[model samples]
Target: MRQNLNYSYPQIFWVEGRPNLGTSCPSAPPIAPFPPPVPDRRRKPKNHTERRSVGLLVTSLLILLALTGVGLSMFRIFHLEKELAELRESASTERIPPALEKLIGQKEQSMKKEARKAAHLTGNPSQRDLPLEWEPTSGHAFTSGIQYCDHGLVINETGFYFVYSNVLFRGSVCSNQVLTHVVYKKNPTLPGSHVLMEDKGINYCMSQKTWARKSYLGALFKLRKMDSLHVNVSKIALVNFEESKTFFGLFKL
Candidate 1:
């Protein structure tokens, strides 16, 4: 026998002898619709404006820290400068000692006196007297610290002086006798001329004919203002009148 079957309903399957419903291998079971997807509850995505605002806040904080550091450095520098200026001002106010100031003034006065007094006088050959007086040469006399008057040098300041003189004596014949040289000073306090230095030369020449001799006298003496000095020799005619050969000079020491 032949039979027509319909499969419109798949839940039921007909076997060779009986119709089966809910068979394990005849058809698949119905599938329930998928449940809605669960929402992500732990984290939320940030918007563009929120991200920009957070970055701006961080940038502002960093700028504020940098400016504070700069201000602190500048304040330290200014304080140090103020301290340095105060130190300088204090140093400027320090005082010098009175004794030192007086000493300095005295030294200045001494130097001024030294600058004002010096004299050098040369000799003239044509003069009289065995212990002859000397006149300053016409064009060769030097008077800076003192004055020259009539064959004498006058002091202008009271101080120690280095007095010096050079005399050249020559003759056609040698006497080899005693040659006397004297430097004398005349002052208001003394009655007559006082000798400051004296020298006597004996046997100074080895030759009997065409003999020549030279004498030099120099010494330090305390002289007063208004004192006058002169150079005197044993023989006037024997002395060389050459300005370079004979000279008398004194300087304040």
Candidate 2:
């Protein structure tokens, strides 16, 4: 026996220092060394067309916006040009011939002269406990369809009317008297005047001092043609006939 033995293959087992080369483990395959692990320098998109598509979409949007803005600008310019043309035409046609201008001026003057007046009655005359009379030409007195005739308003047309009246009662000395104000409607058809509204004032003022009080009445009534309306007071001597404080009016609805 040899003191030492040498074999090409690795010995698997030994018995009493003798080498047994019948079975041996196979050597692992050699792994090639990775080339130092190169750091990635070039960038890449996961999808090949991703970056290109995004850039193209941005460029397309910009182009579309430019086109839309250009279209809107052109449209606005066209609309403004059309309006300018219309204005120019209107300006050109605004002038009238001299004869037509005179006629129009005369027509305007006539219309102004014939302007409708309101039915605002504010005027004079009444005795104590008597029907009041009004002056038609003074203190905002005007008549349109309602005629102020002989202390009464005569309706020219049949329709509903709003009648209003105000009476101011005052005295130098307070006299606790019952002051009555009444508005009546009369016509040839009725025997007596029909009372439309009335107001009574009792103990209205302080006992010793001079006092003033107002009675205002307004109402809507269905009146007929030629219906007459009048205002009456119980004590006319105590009435303050200030135009601003006392007025009667009827307006056709």
Candidate 3:
């Protein structure tokens, strides 16, 4: 007898007297590889905005600090300027006391009066009279209370006057002789000149070559207005013209 086989259905086979089934089926479609993870675009925008806000905050803080510093400096400058202006205003409005002003005026007047009553004169090298003519030292000679005329100092005020004179005598040969210096005063009431003070130097230097002597006279006397005062030396030729060596002066007490 011939055997029949079927291909469209499952086939069964017997082994050791047990049945086993075999089946043929199409494979499932190949599974696609998992797709790459996508980035979270919303989260990225939020993070960027946060960073920008932080930057802006920092910039604002820095700007505020700068502006504060500038404002403080300007305030300090303005304060200093205001203080300076106040000081200037106070100085401009300040005034000296009246008592101080009066004292200053009195002092000035006293100084002027003192200046007017003093005189200093130097010897004249060309004088030939008994009463020596003196040349008043320009810077050192000043007389407001008296007039200097010819060889005489004419007093214009009456007071106790302190008179002084110095005569320096120098020669190639020492004279052991006496050297005399005198201060004399004359007035309308007196017929002639009266000696106020006299100085005599006897044997002032030893007899030798290049000898020098100085005669000085100083005294205080009551003087009348219009009194004329003069200086005299024993030998006019021996009198030194140097201001320091020979001088005459007077002051009122």
Candidate 4:
């Protein structure tokens, strides 16, 4: 019998029932093994990568804290420097004792008084037959008081005065003359001059080719204002006018 040959049946290419997509569809690209479910490293991380990221974040935070701490320390250092400067300035302006200042002033006044009322003079030979005129401008010689009519040192203020005089009698020939040194005070109220200090050299430098004798007179006396002092020697020719040899001075006490 002749059957209908146009009947349709299902097409079978694989006998194992599962289609091999690589071999069955040769026109398509060979199917990969789904790429083993590849993961996005940017979105998802491994265990060690997560730990590294966490550690990096912790290290960044620590660095930021350290910088902030350094800033605060610098600020505190500047503030303390300013405070220390102020303390030093205040200490420099501290007050001194009042008694110490008074003592300094008193010492200055005493020095001024000594310069004002004192007189130191060296011997000066004069042609006039009066008391010896003194050389005030000689070495180590000064006169704070003025010359009383070119005679002697004039007292400016009344006080206790220590008067002193030295006379050196030197001669080439030894005659043993009486060397007399006399310091006298002449006041305008008094009629004549009064002797304040006196000394005599007798039998001094007796036996020698060159002989020298010295007479010194020194005394402290209560003097008055405007009183003039004068030094007199017995023989002006025998007196040596050297600074150390003959000198006269007076100071108020």
Q: Pick the candidate with the highest TM-score.
A: 3
* Residue range 1-45, candidate 2, lDDT tens digits: 767766566647774686567665575587988788766769653
- Residue 94 alpha-carbon offset, candidate 3, angstroms: 14
lDDT of 1 by residue, 1-253 (tens): 6676766865776775667775576455768999999989787876899999999999999999999999999999999999888878867986446897799999989887777688777776677754445555466776776888767888878889999998888888877578888889999877988998888889877776787778889999999989998888887778887888888988887
Q: Which pairs clash (backbone N, Cα, C closer than 3 Å) in model 1?
A: 117-145, 118-145
Q: Which clashing pairs does model 4 show?
A: none
lDDT of 3: 0.81
* Model 1 misplaced stretches (Cα beyond 4 Å): 1-113, 129-140
**Which tens-of-lDDT digit does each residue in 26-67 have in candidate 3?**
545878999999988767445778899999999999999999
Candidate 2 backbone collisions, by pair: none
Candidate 4: count the clashes.
0
User: lDDT of each structure?
Assistant: 0.81, 0.81, 0.81, 0.81
| Model 1: per-residue Cα lDDT at residue 174 | 73
How displaced is residue 139 in candidate 3, in Å? 5.0
